[model samples]
Target: MAFVTIRDVAQKAGVSITAVSQILHGKGRFSNETKELVRRTVDELGYVPDSRAQGIRLAESKTVGLLVPDIRNPFFADLVSSMEKMLYEKGYSTLIGTSAEDVERQDAFITTLLGQRIDGAIVVPEGAESPGIRSIIDRDLPLVFVDRTVEGLDTVPSVVSDPYPGIESAVETLSQLGHRRVGFVSHSSLESVSVNEREVAFRAIAGRVLGEDGVAVVDCDNTFRSRKDALMELLSEGVSAILFAYSPDAIAIIGLLHDRNMDPGTDISVVSFDDIDAFRLMTPRVAIISQQTADMGRQGVEMLLSRIGAKRRRRAEHRRIPTVFVQRGSVGVAPPERRM
Candidate 1:
């Protein structure tokens, strides 16, 4: 099949080629509706601007780096897809890389992208302190953090979900349903802003609702075995409902429960912070605290491009999109005495 081009996009959108160019450059005098029409047309036609040609026109590399902590999780994969689509529409190529939550690889990926002379980067930070992140700032390369922010690196622009409201909602829902014992499961790393924020919120809200000992927390490091162990630990602690801090962890815990002839909605309630497609098809749909992941990805790319144009920002910009509570069948009222 022939490659789709800007002219084809313009023709389909009923706009001039110049309008398409100006819209892509974010300088079009066209109305917002016209621009959106062009965007939707570009998306439908799967048009990608030629990088070498656009590089010459813009005098830029026309390339950007997208560094993700891990792609195995649907959340990160969806995030990358959203950012990639937006950046592609804006006529930039993405150099995608994954660190698998390894700090060393995070630095290495940065060095590699820098050597490639990429114009900018959007990263999901692996941990709090990173020399590579600092170097990116020192070089003044356009950079933005998605989903998480490096600890103490408040000077860098970031797009993250404010999880407190969702956490509070979950706590209230569980409490009103007669859940007095709830467990929290998550990664041991707290350097990432989202994990730290969610954990703090859970402690403050769920802690108060359930009392001190009523709440159980199991923080594990890398490895599926560790995650499973954490979930098992929480179950052994006699939690009436389990709140998995991540979607992947919740899925894993469900598999473990099934293996032991346990049911999620009845044997013990389960809720996940992130939503997955499979959650809906389960025997009892899993409750979810849905983050504004698509918006986060879009804003990250927008901030990176804006920073790239400004060369340096006078003040670091930060945006925290709110999460939505999605009710499903994964939560139920606690039994009178509970059964282990």
Candidate 2:
């Protein structure tokens, strides 16, 4: 089949090429019915417009590139949805790319979006060594980092959670529940800002609150399986309560406990940094330190747009979104048997 063009759409809709062009480009004095007919004919004929051609014609593609670690993660899904909604309302569209937590893949995504001449980009970087994400900043391509940020790219605009409020609340709440030695489940050091912040805060806050040597930290990969041995190690040391750094760690720990004939919340207490619906719906609802995922998305896009042309006269803009703590049944008085 031949490539359908605007001419074909105009002929099928019984309108002049000029009228079709006008309506297609959102111009001209055309009735709603006429516009609808042209749109339907364009769709029926599968007349796909060349975005590069369109970009040249409009001077701006009116499109933004968005990159995430993984779309399967519920938090990322929610973030992309909210960001897309907000951008759509502003008459802009998003071109989404996934890195799947691989640095090379992330670089490839950045290169592809850049090649497409994306007006700007928003990224939730996978780690500190995200050259792909950093390239956007180096080239001054209107970029905003959400959730976690790459190191040395602090000059770029960013929106990240402090993680102190909710973490402090968790330590305080656990201490009140008579937990002396609370374990922290997190990724290894130098992985990403998110993990590093959580680890630093946990050591400083939880250690200070629980007293010297009161905190036991398990620095492992993001996977539960990768951290399972660390979990058992912490368990063997008689940690009365454990704080999961993310949703995956929490879910994995819960499963591990059940498998070993240990009861979550009863045999040991649990707290998570990332809030998820599954945590709430679990048999023993898990307390969570919650980040404003949707708000982060909205704020990130707003910042990117504001800095699209470096219009804002400043060194760099940074927004630190605070987190909240949600209480649930999963955290209880530390079991006497487990208390050190």
Candidate 3:
């Protein structure tokens, strides 16, 4: 069967094609009776309005683009799922891109999204100083940042955890439990604002509480093997407790410690920043600094929608979300033998 078009609906409903277009686009003045007649005809005819045609007519795509550093990361995956769900309900579609922690890849994704004429975007930028992010900001597209904040660009709304207070609380908890030589495991380089904040906060807190001889900062290459090696090195150096930047790295360290016949709860204590589903099932539950992943995703979509609507009205706005710390079994008193 030939596809039903606006002309067919208009003819069947005894209305003009422009009337049908106006009704479908939710624009122009029309009587309620005429609008109801057009809508009923559309339903009966199974006529699906051509989105592309409508987009061309209005000069708007009615689509949003979402960019993340790594889709494989459970945190980003959950975030995407939440955003997509919210966008679907709001009559908008999403185009997703992954940067894989590379600036060039992020730049390419941004360029492609722009080329596709996406009305707005949500980006979890790779770094605060990334030139690609600056380029996107320069375009003045309706943009929001998730998970990380860029320093120079303050106008864009960002949803992120305040890492300092959380890190400080973790340090204080460990210290009160008699942990002296505490170590921190984080991804290499303080390029991303969230990472930088966590690192800076951890070091400052650890130094203030544990003193000069009590802190160790270890850079994890953000891989399983590298994280395992880093943990082994820390353990060898007599560090009894650690604050991990993320759950996956904490898992890697735990696995390595298990291989060395170290008991996570008794021999060493660990606290992770992000909670994954698997963390709850671990033998000793992992303590986590949890971000509201679903809320973040939902908020991102809401922000994008606001930007799209406001752009139509020539306006813009910014938004932010909060984070929380969840205590679990993984963090505990420091072993006397391992105390500095």
Candidate 4:
């Protein structure tokens, strides 16, 4: 089939090619009637803009690249969808890359995206030492970090969820419900600023609500066996209630509880971060510290767009979306026997 061109649309609509181009790009002023006519003609002719040709002419691909650590994580999936929708509305397409929580893979994806000549990038970097992040910094390409920021990368803007609000609420609620001691299961194996922030926030809040001696902490790797061991450790610490900073560990713990014929709420109260579907759909709905993924996505896109449209690179800024605690069946009254 012959590819329909803008020239064909211009001829059919009785307008100059520039008129069609301006209308399609939402650029130069055009009468409503003229714009409608051009759009109708373009639709009838099935004329799709040649992004490559346009990029060569305008020096912009009109595309944005997004990198996430794990797309399988419902939070990232929702974030990607939200960002893609907003970018599309702004006349830009999104190229998505998943790193699978690997530093080398993260750099590789960044390199590949750079090759695409994306106008800007929003990355959830694995860490600050990534050469890929440095390349973007050296080239001065518009870049925004989402979910977490790199250590000492003061020049790059970031949007992350504020854990204090949700952590404070979760600890207070548990304390009020007779949870004298609470354990925090942290994903310490991963070098993530946000994860560390969550851990610190929990310790502070738990200490304030239940006393410093009430706080129990354990590090867990991203593995079923490790999470199981962490849960056992927290139980041995005599924690009546427990919070998992990572959602995967919470899911694994729920299964492990079932294997031991223990109930999540009755035998031990449970709470975790991220309001993903898996948590909501569990037998006893798991309590969540929702990071507001939609808000994070919107903020990231807005920040990246501002950088991309600016005449000169502006001073980097950081934005935080406050997380909220969601009460669920998983957070039942702390067992009297388990209470300190």
For model 1, what is the C-alpha lDDT against the true structure?
Answer: 0.81
In candidate 2, residue 33 scores what lDDT?
100
* lDDT rank order: 4, 1, 2, 3
Give the TM-scores of the predictions, in the order they appear.
Answer: 0.79, 0.80, 0.76, 0.83
Q: Candidates 1 and 4: which is better by TM-score?
A: 4
Candidate 2, 165: how far from true, in Å?
Answer: 0.8
Tell me the tens digit of each residue's lDDT in model 2 across 56-83: 3234678899998888877778889989
Q: Candidate 4: TM-score?
A: 0.83
> How do the residues 239-334 of candidate 3 rate in per-residue lDDT, one tens digit apiece?
888888866677777888888887776888888887677778887888887777888777777776776676343334444445566778888788
Clash tally, candidates in order = 0, 0, 0, 0
Q: Which stretch of 10 consecutive residues in model 4 shows the poorest summed lDDT?
A: 50-59
Model 2: colliding residue pairs = none
Candidate 3 has a TM-score of: 0.76
What lDDT tens digits, residue by residue, belong to model 1 across residues 250-288? 787888888988787777888888766778878889999
Q: Report the C-alpha lDDT of model 4 over 1-340, residue by residue, as the tens digit.
A: 2245678888899999888889999999989999999999976765556645542324567989999999998888999999999999999999999999898899878767765667899998896568778777776789999998899998999999999999999998998899998999999777899988999999888888889899999999987778888988987899888898888888888898899888888888899999899988897999999999989999999999998888886999999999999989989898888777
Candidate 3, which segments miss by more than 4 Å at Cα? Answer: 1-57, 128-135, 223-225, 311-322
Cα deviation in Å at residue 85, candidate 4? Answer: 1.1
lDDT of each: 0.81, 0.80, 0.77, 0.87
